[model samples]
Target chain A: EDQVTQSPEALRLQEGESSSLNCSYTVSGLRGLFWYRQDPGKGPEFLFTLYSAGEEKEKERLKATLTKKESFLHITAPKPEDSATYLCAVQPPGGTSGSRLTFGEGTQLTVNP
Target chain B: AAGVIQSPRHLIKEKRETATLKCYPIPRHDTVYWYQQGPGQDPQFLISFYEKMQSDKGSIPDRFSAQQFSDYHSELNMSSLELGDSALYFCASSLPNQPQHFGDGTRLSIL
Candidate 1:
């Protein structure tokens, strides 16, 4: 079974503070790694998709990097609005279409202003 | 750009009752996926469809059934609802090998 594990279940930071969340995974053949941000009682919003090691992508205050065995979501100078549960999910290689995602427990980040 | 849209944002049901959740995929996207997230838990894959055909299955209960229509819309039919069925159900859509975009989700509550 494909598995994903995220470190630092909960994190607290002051406004403008920077930090990185980690997600480790084990899959038969990784097709993609995804990052999503979810607010309380809300569906996850898409963040980034890292397809290969040494790949990195960024969006505003967030940057995502992937390695062969893990991925990192680096929050740069975060603000209170950036606080949310960050989720990491992995997609395994599959046939035709619509591969399922295996998600980690997630890291709840709280940025205090 | 349009995002995945889910209907009946919230539903309340009693045990043994049935409920249906609907999803409209983003335009030009052909794959739809269903996921269930319990309180304080990450979303769990339930099922998926592509090109109006069932393409994958996961931890979905036997009482739950879902299908994608010709219009690329999908519905999840859940029967014999139990308290354990209460959760946030999310629908996502994407093109082949692309990142899936999620809907706001339907919050289901069983009493």
Candidate 2:
């Protein structure tokens, strides 16, 4: 069975603090790994897509990197506005790999001022 | 300049009633997906439709079904709703093999 697990289910940080969230997966094949940010009462927003190991993508204060069995979303000097639930999902399928995204439980990030 | 759109931002229905949620994918995007998110959890893939065909289904129950229209819009139908059915349902759109965009989601409450 393919499964994705996220660490530190909930996190709290002070303004300007940097942290990294982890997502580990057990799958037959990894087509892609995705990162999303979801605010309360809204849908999960697309953040990054990592396809292979050592690959990295960045947006504003957030960065995502992938390895063979895990992915990490790093927040640098995060502000209160950056506080939201960070989700990690992986595309695991032999065919199509079209739009099916298997997601983790998400890391709830709260940046306190 | 449009994103995925969903209808009935909030809905409430009694148990055993049928509920239908709608989604409009962005123009020219051929793939759309439906996901269910429980409070304090990640979004779970409910179904994915591509090219008017059902590509995949997650661990949803038999009472849940979905359809993809010719214009790439889609609908999720739930028959005989139960208390467990209450959650936020989201619609997502993306080009084949590209990153997906999400809608605001519809919160469904089953009483």
Candidate 3:
């Protein structure tokens, strides 16, 4: 079974604090690793996709890095607006149908002003 | 820069009632996926379609069925609603081998 595990289920950070969320996964053939941010009562917003080890992507205050068995979502100098649940998901290689993502229990982040 | 669209942003139903949720994928995208998120839980994959065909399924109950239309829009039909079925239903669209774009979800409340 493909599985994704995210650590530090909840985090409270002072504004401008930096921290990294962890996502570890086990899959038969890794196809893609995805990161998303979801606010309360809202659908998840796509953040980044990592395909191979050593790959990295960045947005304004967020950076994501991928490794062979895990991924990291690094929040740099986060602001209150950046507070949201961060989700991690993985797409495995082939199945009878189209690719379906396996998601982790998200890490809830609160950036306190 | 059009995004996926979902209908009936909020719905309230009683047990044993039936409900239908709809999704319109972004133009030029051929794939659509349905997911369910319970209160305080991560989104769970329910099903997917590609080219109007059922492509993948996961954790979906037998009372729930979904399909994609020729226009690349999709519907999720759920029957015999239960309190456990109350959730936020999300629809996502994407091209083959591309990242998916999601719509603001439909919040279903079953009493």
User: Using Cα atoms with residue i matched to residue i, what is each candidate's TM-score against the true structure?
Assistant: 0.98, 0.96, 0.97
Q: Each candidate's DockQ score against the native complex?
A: 0.86, 0.70, 0.65
Q: After superposition on all CA atoms, how large is the RMSD of candidate 2?
A: 1.2
Ranking by DockQ: 1, 2, 3
Candidate 3, superposed: residue stretches over 4 Å from native: A95-97
lDDT per residue, candidate 2, B38-71, as tens digits?
A: 8777788889888889987887789999999988
Tell the DockQ for candidate 3: 0.65
Better of 2 and 3 by lDDT: 3
Candidate whose TM-score is highest: 1
lDDT by residue (tens digit), candidate 1, B21-47: 999999999999999999999999999
Query: lDDT per prediction?
Result: 0.96, 0.89, 0.93
lDDT of 1 by residue, A6-110 (tens): 989999999999999999999989989999999997888999999999999999999999999999999999999999999999998887789999999999999
User: Which residue pairs in candidate 3 have backbone atoms (N, alpha carbon, C) closer than 3 angstroms, thus clashing?
Assistant: none
RMSD of each: 0.8, 1.2, 1.3
Tens-digit per-residue lDDT, A1-113, candidate 2: 67999988999999999999999999888888999998999888889989999999999999999999899999999999998988898887446624578889989999999
- Model 1 chain A is weakest, by summed lDDT over 10 consecutive residues, at A92-101
Model number with the top lDDT: 1
